[model samples]
Target: MSFINYSSREINCKIVYYGPGLCGKTTNLQYIYNKTSSEAKGKMISLATETERTLFFDFLPLSMGDIHGFKTRFHLYTVPGQVFYDASRKLILKGVDGVVFVADSQIERMEANLESLDNLRENLEEHGFDLDKLPYVVQYNKQDLPNAAPIEELKNLLNPTNVPDYPAIATTGEGVFQTLKAVAKLVLLELKKKR
Candidate 1:
């Protein structure tokens, strides 16, 4: 759900980046943070374990243009990708307006990707949000790796629903913004429909 602040005339929507461990969720946020102008983004807060893996989430609030009359702000977040952090993942999905599933494209990580995808669906269901109805996109990250699976194979395995997927190398910024823009557009479109 989105939160609308009438006094400030701003609409705040939450978009979560979810995937298995080391799937480059944090890297995507760091790239976006580094490239975004200071004026359009808020301070990025990241809570991590000693190993630097995100323990909870990375929050980056971005202010886009206006909708009808209210300014639209997107709060981007990344749920901890470790399987043990399922509790934390559920917490982060509490009020998500959109989701990006970052699937690791390494051929060896196929099972991990499937497990994480299933976890995403289960977690969302626990919160009463059906994955199929949500504004969602799949990002096949780490595509530059030598052992990365072919795009066709990845599509068959992770994106059978065919909901706006992208090939990405998150560390180098390839397809990063494209993925974000696609999901953000969906989020905004959903918002407009509700108005």
Candidate 2:
């Protein structure tokens, strides 16, 4: 959901990056943080373990130019990808206006990918959202890795609904901003329809 702050004339929307453990969710956030100018963003807060695993979520607030009369602000979040953090993921997903499902494209991580995706569906259901109805996009990350599966196979397995999908090498920043812009645009358009 998006909050319209009449006082500030801003539209704030939450966009979450979700995937299995080590699937580049954090990397996606980091890339955006590094690429965005400080004037356009706020502090990025991360709650992670000593080993650097996300224990809760990484929150990044960004102002993406402007649309019409309202300034658009995106609150980017990343869920803890480990299976043990399922509860935390569900909690973070509350009020999510859009989602980026980042999938690890390495061939060896296929099982983890499927399990994580299944978990995503179940969790969304618990929140009363249909995966198809939600504004969702797919990111096939780790494309630079050796033995990565072909993009076609990843699509067939992970994207049965055929939502907008991108081949991403998130570590180097490829396709990161495009993915964000795509989801953000969808979210904003959804808001437009409501008004």
Candidate 3:
């Protein structure tokens, strides 16, 4: 969804970080929140459980360098990935202009990653959007883990479509910006098409 600030002539777009359980979606957001200059971003807010699991979502508003005079504003969100939280996931997918699918790269978690992607597709279609057509990116998160699958294997199984993909270690901030900028660029291009 977009909100036009007539006084400022700016349009804000929403981008969601979506993925499976414990896939570092929140960690990615946290890294960004920490790295961004305070003058350029808002406070990070989490609607979560006592155990730190996302109960609803986490939100952070960010600004990119001005584009064509309008300072690009992005409202980032993360959905609860627990299977029981399916309803919450569907809710957050609404009004999403772009998505970053954070995939756990460990070999053993391959099935979970695919299942989550399938769920994402189904949920998007329910909103009348096609996954292939959406402004989407893939982040093979937790790449620092030794048990993680090789990037080539992960790419073959997870991103055969060749969407812009990033190898990320979210906790240490490696590749986080690359993922952010990739999706942000795609989102802007999508908006440009609309104009």
Candidate 4:
């Protein structure tokens, strides 16, 4: 559900970064917030629990260049990955225009990645969004870790439909922009089709 604010000449789209707990979803958003020029980004907000250890959500607003005379803006969000926060995850997914699944690359986290992906599908379905039809991409994060899983194995398990996927070390910003660029391109293209 992209919003066209004609008065502001802006097209706003929401992109959610989803994955298992500590899978670098938030890191991706943080890297982008730090690297992007101030003029191209808005405030970066992270909502944390009372203990200051629990992350509730992370939000960042980004402005891409205009398309067809309309300024394109993307609001990036990351849902809380803890199992107890499943309800919050579903809520964050509502009205999403695109999604980026950040899969932890460690071999031991494979099962977690699978479970999270399944959750994503189920939650998206609840919102009347089909995973197959949505503008989506996968990011294999923490690639620099010594125990990272082989890219081929990760691809076989996570990207069976062959969506655009990128290998990224989000902490260092490697492949971060590429992952964002691919999904944002698909999102803007979808907006054009809708128009």
TM-score of each: 0.97, 0.98, 0.97, 0.96
Sliding window of 10 residues with minimal summed lDDT for model 3: 1-10
Predicted candidate 2 versus true structure: per-residue lDDT over 67-121, tens digit per residue:
7688999999999999999989999999999999999999999899999989988
* Each model's lDDT: 0.95, 0.94, 0.92, 0.93
lDDT of 3 by residue, 1-195 (tens): 666676896879899998999999999999999999998899999999999999999999999877667788999999998889999999999989999999999999999999999999999999998989889999999988999999999999999799999999999999999999999899888877887
| Model 1 Cα shift for residue 37 (angstroms) | 0.4
Full-model lDDT, candidate 4:
0.93
The lDDT ranking, best first, is: 1, 2, 4, 3
- Give one digit per residue, the lDDT tens place, for model 1 in 83-190: 999999999999999999999999999999999999999999999999998999999999999999999999999998999999999989999999999999999889
Model 3 bad stretches (over 4 Å):
4-6
| Candidate 1: pairs in clash | none
Worst ten in a row by lDDT for model 4: 48-57
List the candidates ranked by TM-score, beginning with the highest: 2, 1, 3, 4
**Worst lDDT window (10 residues) for model 2?**
64-73
Predicted candidate 4 versus true structure: per-residue lDDT over 52-123, tens digit per residue: 423667999999998779899999999988778999899999999999999999999999999999999999
The TM-score obtained by model 2 is 0.98
Clashes of each: 0, 0, 0, 0
Q: Candidate 4 versus the native: TM-score?
A: 0.96
